[model samples]
Target: MLLELIEYHWAEDIDEVLLLLGRLDVKTVPLAGGTYLLGLHDDSIESVVDLRDLDLAYISEDARGIHIGAMTTLQQMVDSPLLKELFAGLLARAAKNSSSSRLIRNSATIGGTIATGSASQADLLTALAVLDAEVVVRSGSKTQVDLKGGSYEHPGLALAGVVYKGKHERRIPSGEVQLSRRPAELIIEVVIPRPTLAVGTALMRVSRTPADVSLLHAAALIEIDAHTYRKVHLALGGSNMEPVRLYGVEQMLEGQPVMNPLNSQKLLTILQEGMATFRPPADIRASSSYRRVSGMGLAYRALEEAMNVASWQNVMSSERGS
Candidate 1:
């Protein structure tokens, strides 16, 4: 927490920021909003390269997907009209629920949120995972790391070169360089691909108070075609260091009818079974058993909500056609 010894450098561009960070004489960290860096008590950090002057704050959409700059704040995300309209406001709602304090939301940048690797931000992280977000990073070179259906180790790992990238950008296949050996990389932006088919998304969280961090949370995204599920994504977090996608449950629901009585019962049973076998970390806020039970219920409800939204979309389409 000692700030007296640390030096701050205002970086005008990405290359300058990289040069400052690559200094062998001092340990340096990039600063965006500085919300996360200010909380760290590490004495090894000798300098901070401020990126505010780099102009890395904007939100736009193209044929590929929605592009959010790394320096965009949580409040900005919540206030974005584009986000509110996309996927039924899944990203906007997640950003709004991330923190009850307006001050925190305004000061915390999206890049820092993902780079800090905090489990308490599960609600927002899970939503991003369910959307299959791709993180764009730059160091000596540029690469786009895929979250890969939320199966990647952690969002932060993308910065460490531990995650695999798609063929579009420079491909850095997983295991090419271990996390410990990777050079410092800066997150440039996050890209979320637009869904081609009718899609619904939902996010749910359990917390002691509105201001308190989540004890457990779930997020789901579903695409339907002709009353049948064409694709499904489900992610859970809050009890662990990283959010986890429920691949088993997603696979079971994909290609199935939107949820008949039999399908609902079967899905519930499978979710319960999966939750029972998986263990969450125990912490002072809640016990592992409590998190397990909450996760099971949260996941089911999130999936149900997403399915209902998809059904409503179908109904509206039919009404319009008539």
Candidate 2:
């Protein structure tokens, strides 16, 4: 893999990267771990501004939330106590399945993958979406990261970019539903957080197998009080542009009884309402109709699993006297 014609620049600071970015696209690109980006051998990438020397790979926690330096390796996150304690399922699961191997993870950068934006394997987005993660992109002397933790990056990491400090979902009994096929596959991560009394369900699944991209995905957070649902937040990925929030479905669930898996008929009905609103893109992976239908199914399953986790936690804590 000798990049015979390409020259490598080991940049140490922001200004150094920016200077390189100002240059028009030639055979140039930025490199951190050189995991994915390096795989593509473009004739234009004659010079790679290596960012490994920037010391961007580190994980720290404070009052705000976990601050993951863009350069942090996947193994670092997989082994992080902070990640283990906070976003237990997502970090551990996504790290293993998101890429091809541990060696890749060692070379992969959180910033790199995240900055790629709208990747077929939308792991970090789901993980952050579950926890209401924020993305920080820096340019010039100023920086703007989404405070609401919305998806979509500014595009172009080659210039001067950084994706940093996204939070994880907070777990409360009957709080949010997190659904994925294998806890160890490259499936989307979803979290549905409730406003209060109701349950939130985040549904994520791949239409094809482990090696394929997820055909359907969703995240819905609702509040339930006395079996009555309220303040629902329904968001879907893999359909529409970026991810879409289902306001119509949320409106329907406002006063309805929480459909916690057991009520298949009612759950299906709500899911139907959700499917009706979707106009998913058709591709070789799956047709629009299939993706729409499966998205509903994933939502149903995710809600059920979330409830089970809630129930399990309640029982465990009661027994432990915590």
Q: So what's the TM-score on candidate 1?
A: 0.84
Cα RMSD, each candidate = 10.8, 12.3
Write down the lDDT of every candidate, Cα atoms only. 0.76, 0.54
Model 1, clash count? 0
Query: Could you tell me the lDDT of residue 232 within candidate 1?
Result: 92
Model 2 ranges with Cα > 4 A deviation = 1-6, 24-28, 141-203, 217-247, 250-262, 311-322
Best by TM-score: 1
Runs in model 1 lying further than 4 Å from the true structure: 2-4, 119-122, 141-183, 260-263
lDDT of 2 at 319: 62
**Whole-structure CA lDDT of model 2:** 0.54
Top candidate when judged by lDDT against the true structure: 1
What TM-scores do the predictions have? 0.84, 0.66
Can you write out model 2's per-residue Cα lDDT over 255-305, one digit (the tens) per residue?
776545467787678768755868766766678787676767776676566
lDDT of 1 by residue, 195-272 (tens): 744788899888888778888888899888877899899888784436777888887778888774436778788797
